[model samples]
Target: MPHTRRDHAVVLGASMAGLLAARVLSESFGRVTVVERDALPVDVLATGSRHRRGVPQSRHVHVLLARGASILEDLFPGFVAEAEVAGARTTDALGQVRLLLSGQRLLQTDIGLRSLLCGRPLLENLVRARVRALDGVRFLERHDIVGLTATPDGRRVTGVRIHADGGEQETALDADLVLDATGRASRAPVWLHDLGHGRPTVDTVQVGLAYATRTYRLPQGAMGKDQLILNNATPENQRAAVLAEQENGLARLTLAGMLGDRPPLDPKAFDAFAASLHFPDIFEAIRDAEPLDDPVGFQYPANVRHRYERMRSFPDGFLVLGDAVSAFNPVYGQGMTSAAMQAEAMRAVLADDRDARNGKPLTWRRYFQAIAKAVNPPWQISAGGDLAFPDVRGRRTPAVRMINAYLPKVHAAAAHDVDMSVAFIRVGSLMDRPESLLRPDIIFRVLRGPGRRHPRG
Candidate 1:
């Protein structure tokens, strides 16, 4: 149990980040309230897994990296078991998943890591149910957030102003701390400006990414032993696709293109895009599968990062986490894992603050600094990947150029070297730091150059 340090904490947004934040806040606050604009599903079990309008990308494929899954299990015991019982699929991270990066297929090897595959809605609903069961946590559904309420000095946030979704009456909810987990569409910058504070420094990488997704029910033997197949886009070929087995015995096929090359939603055109991927497995499996839904499209313009730690002045009682702080390119599947890492950092910082038992309020400075550290690695990875394409607009330093050049060789070597494959998988799964990939031993293997190709079974 954590030491109680505050009376109330309010969290904006009830998505993954908000739910995770509220779960941690409940340990130290007497009351935790989550404000969300959407009316979430009442009975997740009865509803099964369905998409909600609040999350536009819910129809797309979502991957819970090994690190994120570990954190979720720690936060909510039996989470993996519960999810599996609910039809979620799990596979040996590197063994049962096919990964084609830079047009090179990685040799399959069991690295003892677990990959959890399910729709975004199912993952969120599982976590939301756990958060709802906490002693001091409550949710305010169908509420529209208006703005922040701060002290007259503008040095501290006192609460938040919100109104019912369909009603005009505004209400102020007071709290000792306010956390923004509203994700990519967060309005924190404008709210901060309204409080007489300067907005945080912004970093943007314009990739102009787009996605088209559809659901299918494939034959039992279609995929054989493989659970997920990911064909990443390379500079030479700016198209990617993923086919993952999801809950309810269904599969999702999402096609992605970068730099204004949008995947078509038309059925024939969608299949053509899938067929154009680096591998033919996705197209082959879905070509004869039962179509469950028409293709849905979503667009992401740029990777945005708000450097709050660099800001000279910030309110004392407010903090931002998750996509509100940094929205990464989703192609790398780092968003949810990064959010989990941030939530863990917040937990550690709050524990230290509680242990000090100081008379002063919680230090927003220390929290934001910790968050920056957590966001740095993933940001570098996703940003570096986006910048790999010459058409993408970003400043590529010498280091980025060197790493991008070396990564292809590494991918090529992994085709025959199991050690190289494991190392790359570990880093990609957020289980290890990116620096591990540059170690002397891994570099030796990578520099060995391309080896004989291992044909896929």
Candidate 2:
């Protein structure tokens, strides 16, 4: 380990994952500093003072999966209560949502993953405000973490040095442990290589996906009742998706497509994009509503994972989490959930290290592998689903190929079969493992039930 358990710990990012990691580190480390290259939003909520930098997909719709939401609430009690009090709408399982695929309504399942909705900034603001109140955790906004400083033996990481206002001074604020909570722009791999440790292995699943989102006022009587409507495109058609509804009565809508199918950046084209969905209700309802912001777009080329867990060796007292390690496309909306699990897994590791020397415990390498176990399932559920498309080229496993082959039927049956819908939605929401979708009953229903030609809106 680097510093004693009482030394300072530094976090490398301040986004949702970074914030969660900082919150947890405060319990063990004496002082925790989070460094971010992008200037954080002063108001973080409505103002979005920090625009379009590191998280370009912030403009796109962000959904906090049910399991992820539960994890966040566990880490910070009364968080869901806080979000509800603030104006975010907590939606019920596939019940409140009107899912349409291939022009028909996905039936309401008895059990579905429940989640909360709001602009990313709004959610971030609530969490950030809570984190800011912590006594030991601190923030260093607009600063860059150049690299990690290690002990003379080069066997452990002691702290981090940041580049600041026209001066370069290495501050040795040692850490009991260091967590790299930085987002996708993380440089942990490069830093590790510089210290003689090899870079983490890499894994990637790519799809030429894009997003275009705009905000609007929910029409009278239409604010809280409407469900998310998605017109998913299978391999047969390259185009896909539309999500429109409430987040604090302030309606937000997005149009997305895969491969070469791109949504328009203009208001007129945006309307056409919505109307083109399997359902016309959502598009018809908002096509004429006032546009609050200019149409914005973000292109996501691939889903990449840094196989840090598979690495041969890692320095003591150093660890990485969240997008810094495995980043998924925002489309699947697994970011926060995966980070929550990472933080939880780390907490368990820290709790188990009884005989830990000074700062960090000795089981640093073990903890990283444990995190991989927690991350892999969700990664498979997400990127695997994305690459199932015709335009998404990859060498897929037989099971992946099987699941991908039958998903359309599962989706089609879900719209008409109650039991199947419940099973599918629960798995999709991360409330359960993907294998749950393979239950005998679900498979029987998907194959034997009346399959709808289209989903209901």
Model 1 residue runs over 4 Å out of place are 1-5, 359-362, 450-457
Give one digit per residue, the lDDT tens place, for model 1 in 1-457: 1223389999999988999999998988899999999998867666656777778888899999888998999999999999999788887888888898898888986777887999888889888998999999999999988899988988888899999988969999998889999999899988888888888989989999999999999998687678889899999999998899998889998899998999999999999999999788889888899999899999999999999888888888899999999999888888999999999999999888787775555567789899999998898899987888998898899988888888888888888877788889899998998889899988988887765555544
Candidate 2, lDDT over the whole model: 0.75
The local distance difference test score of each candidate is: 0.88, 0.75
Any idea how many clashes model 1 has? 0
Task: Find the number of clashing residue pairs for candidate 2.
Answer: 13
Which ten residues in a row are the worst by lDDT in model 1? 448-457
Models, CA RMSD each: 2.2, 3.2
TM-scores of the candidates are 0.97, 0.90
- Cα RMSD, model 1: 2.2
- Tell me the TM-score of model 1: 0.97
